[model samples]
Target chain A: MKTPVYFDYAATAPVDPRVVEAMLGLLGPDGDFGNPSAVHAYGRKAAALVEEAREEIAALLGVAASGIVFTSGATESDNLAIKGAARAAARRGRHVITEKTAHKAVLDACRALEREGFEVSYLVPDRGGRISAAQLEASLRPDTILVSLLHANNETGVLQDIPALAAAVRRHGALFHLDAAQSAGKVELPLEQVDLLALSAHKFCGPKGAGLLYVRPGVRLEPLLHGGGHERGRRAGTLATHQIRGMALAFRLAVESMAEESSRLAGFSSRLIEGLCALPGVLLNGHREARLPNIVNVSVEGVDGEALQLALRDIACSSGAACNSASGEPSYVLRALGRDDALAGASLRFSMGRWTRVEEVDYLLERFGSELTRLRRIAGAA
Target chain B: MDELHDPARYSPRVLELFDRPARLGPPPGANREGQAENRARGSWLRMYLQVEAERVVAAGFHARGCPHTIAAAELACEALTGSDASELAEYRAEFLEAALPLPPEKLDVRLLIEDAVRAAAHGRR
Candidate 1:
């Protein structure tokens, strides 16, 4: 059976073997089984390893170890960052700002905040999927307490200018939080100036169940999930030593290989964009130059994304976020970027990864061209 | 090979009944006469069928689906012809027993034939 290529790395990535190896010791009987908060020597060993891993991840991102707090993954981190911050800052202002295309975690948290009576402004992006820095500045009101924007879009790979937008939010005294789930390991992030930021290890070849939330020293957040008070009262749980170690390894590897992977994936992404663009009536969804090197979103008219997806069973792609696949609605991201419902519904998000090969790309191009032709015929356009 | 185009494997019983492919049915269409002549009020596999009782005429159809849907549409028109309310009202999926049975997933197509028979028989055919 012929299967399509796997081009949905932005959704999730296959954990590297190195991460698995690092995790083994922690899961085994010989590993650090004791809790970090315990008084026993085994607990001390485990606690030290967790702290070391935190430092490792911090080093990779060029941040202080004290600023990094471990969470279950990106989703939890986003919730803790937005909901926690919004609720804590509710006394100051109940109004907050964010782009409509943010990952569901951010949006859901904002929605939950909305239920609690905090007003949220979901900024609509321009045609290229960029939330203009000026628009963000304009949206900030005296009542707005926080501005939460994504670092890189999960569906379109659209990269937002963090420092620029953060500066705008800073002027209004609202906290700035960045969801770097898709950008953290693959690209450089401006973590130094931002009040808060979130990251997940799995997006960058790290192990699953490991993520980081960066809260500036002075920022205040009400904990979203209550537990044993493990993460300096910000989060409470026994740290998963193996997951943290694996994440630290993955983070270090990603940082060290960034220069290499970025260039390589950029080349592959360029080839993909060029090949797809050659087809008639196809359009690009995100800012061509302002997006991540590894992601490309394309719209092929006269093709049903679901049908094309079903037809290209071998090549794994995502029409939108993994969370919204069941809804089968047009991508909210593309729609925010001014895409019509039909065009948004017809889009395909192909994100390149560390293991992507030129041959696989070539195969995808062939498959896409053929599938587009067939779908058009079925729709009577061809 | 396109296994879809060959009609030998399928049947033209629906088209044979209406004996007309006027591009209009009970839902909506360009020809007022053809649409008005068939009350065929219901949904075909791809088309919507509506029948008018007063004139025994049927008209108008809208097909927002595929070829199998369009073909089943043609099947709908056949499933309703030369019959009045009592005669064609009894037609059922058994009517399709002699023709190509759609896969389990394509039951929507069968629905088209059923509605067509009821509407055309009781409608303004």
Candidate 2:
């Protein structure tokens, strides 16, 4: 049987073959498999590979290699960036600002801080799932130590104006953190404007288990992990040299081909949006113009999102609700934008990526239209 | 591709019922109908039954929910048809739960199916 067409790139992308090949050179007996912390020659070689990987990632983000600190993945990067910074700046202030639509990594970190007597203000986004610069400025207070937000939403592909928002945060005398896990390799990032940024390798065709947090010079953070002074005392752990190498290679490839890939994806997204919107009772989620090119989220009226997802078993996609859980909560991001539970629950996120083709998009459109019509008919929608 | 997918996430029986529901949609000229929903969880079910001499002669269901809930609804309709209406009041979610071997978190699906059937029986009385 033919496998299902993958359309959940927002969740995670397959590692690029080039990245895999690079990783293979660092993994086995003949490879640079020694611990990076060892003082031996093999260890030195491994450490060199790690530093080279860091440079590749730094080059893509337009930041100095020294600013990057590797972690297990974005979740750890987010926790380290937010919690570490918030705790370090606690003496100066106890307040923080973030949008409600941010990934759970940021929100949960903020929530953890809240338990420690810190005040967090979750800014509500507009109907298009966007937080304006004015909104950020208004939310910032004298005690606001940091403002963390996503560069691009994982579910809706909504892109925030990071430069404008960063400027607003800085003007308020607060540090700005961008969870660029979703947008790192997909688009250009204004790294100079952000004080701290988090990224994941798996999101951009790198192997999983490795990510980075870029800390701007002069910024102080309370280390989340303490021991052995790894990551310049910011984080402590034996780095996975192979994973880091793969990430660097993946980031390099993504940056090298970003312009052309983005253009191609934009065309595919446009075709998908056009086709989906032509269906009766279909509504697109998020700002049409301010979203990433690879993801198109839509809500089909009168259809259950779970049923639709099941109907489209041949197309791997995600619903706006957390389908993995029993509660099945509609995406908080959509809810923050004022979408009702039913509409949010009915939304589907079709994310395309490097391997996506025009023919697959057409097939998906047809499948979606037919399944939606069938489901609506069964539901007796007018 | 197999590595990319997880088959164990869904039981084969649930997949079978979801792929080919035995009693989907409303039975023609159903004498009794009932609807139940767990709006917070986005699960909804509408059940129709034809009763003759206090016995369910035919049954069908239409549901919009996850695979477990849909499968449960279909399975309920299959189990209830040709049974005495009084059996509905005694119907327990455990029977369906065991048959489907539903996860603990998905016990709500069994309850939803039971609610639809009981509602249908109540309407007939």
Query: Pick by DockQ: which candidate is best?
Result: 2
Error of 1 at B39 (Å): 22
- lDDT string for model 2 (B59-103, tens) is 887777777887787788877878888777666667877787687
Measured against the true two-chain complex, the DockQ scores of the candidates, in the order shown, are 0.07, 0.44
> What are the per-residue Cα lDDT tens digits for candidate 2 across A222-298?
99898789999999989899999988888888889999999999999999999999998899999999999899999
DockQ of 1: 0.07
Interface RMSD of each: 8.9, 2.8
Docking class of 2: acceptable
Which ten residues in a row are the worst by lDDT in model 2 chain A?
Answer: A373-382
By lDDT, the best candidate is 2
Tell me the whole-model lDDT of each prediction, alpha carbons only.
0.73, 0.85
Model 2: runs farther than 4 Å from truth?
A326-328, B1-9, B52-55, B85-94, B121-125
Q: Encode model 1's per-residue lDDT on A1-382: one tens digit a residue.
A: 2344678899888898888887887887788877888889998999999999988877777878888889989899989989999999999989989989899999998999999999999998888888988999889999998889899998888899777887788888999999989987788989886888998888988887889899888899898767887788899888888888888998888888999999999999999999999999889998989989999998766545544554465688787421135564568788888877667767788998988889999999998898677555433354
